[model samples]
Target: MASVTSAESGRLGTLPLGYYSCSEPGDAGGQAWIDLPDKHFTIGNGSTYHTDAGSGTYLLTGKRVIFTRGPMKGVRFERSGKVTLRWIDEDGKPGRVRCVRQASSV
Candidate 1:
């Protein structure tokens, strides 16, 4: 496989290079101060992403983002907005977890 530099990631990858937070809704009963469990990720160039668990390569095909390697291999998501991604289950159903782009990159 070819290596991709951080600067080249922007031109090679479909998604914007930056930090992202993936979260699932918490059962806080609508409490504002309650925090939802979130996972941090770095969307890097060359269709790559990194999390606390591991790093992975992804493929952006139209609106779908599919993980091709590493810990998240085989996981898939669909682009919900410019800065958001919604998980897609095996049955093609949208999942509760959502990943939102942050203001910075690694």
Candidate 2:
């Protein structure tokens, strides 16, 4: 696999790099968090009972970003803002999320 070296590349237009939280309505238990950087990606939850860790390789095409490997393979993500992304699961469920450039220090 080719390592991501540049934050600004040819295909991926402009992607946010930071922490994102699930913001779908009625999703009170949606503790999922997704972190995307210049290179790889990480997905997890900080909930007390949910112990899960995930990582994957992803690439951007037009308005959609596809996870090519790992747990979220085939998931499609679209930019909602510089610090936000909305995505649909492989099962076709829709969701929206907001992110901050910085992670929580707590």
Which RMSD values do the candidates have, in order? 7.7, 10.1
Candidate 2, residue 97: how far the Cα is off, in Å? 6.1
Global fold similarity of model 2 (TM-score): 0.49
Most accurate candidate by lDDT: 1
**Whole-model Cα lDDT of every candidate shown, in order:** 0.76, 0.47
What tens digits encode model 1's per-residue C-alpha lDDT throughout 1-106? 9995442233223788898777777666774323233456788878888877889899876677878998788888888788998889889788887888876666
Candidate with top TM-score is 1
What is the C-alpha lDDT profile of model 2 across 39-63, one tens digit per residue? 2233333211111355656666555
Worst 10 residues of 1 by lDDT: 4-13
Candidate 2: which stretches are off by over 4 Å? 1-10, 27-51, 89-106
In model 1, how large is the Cα lDDT of residue 9? 39
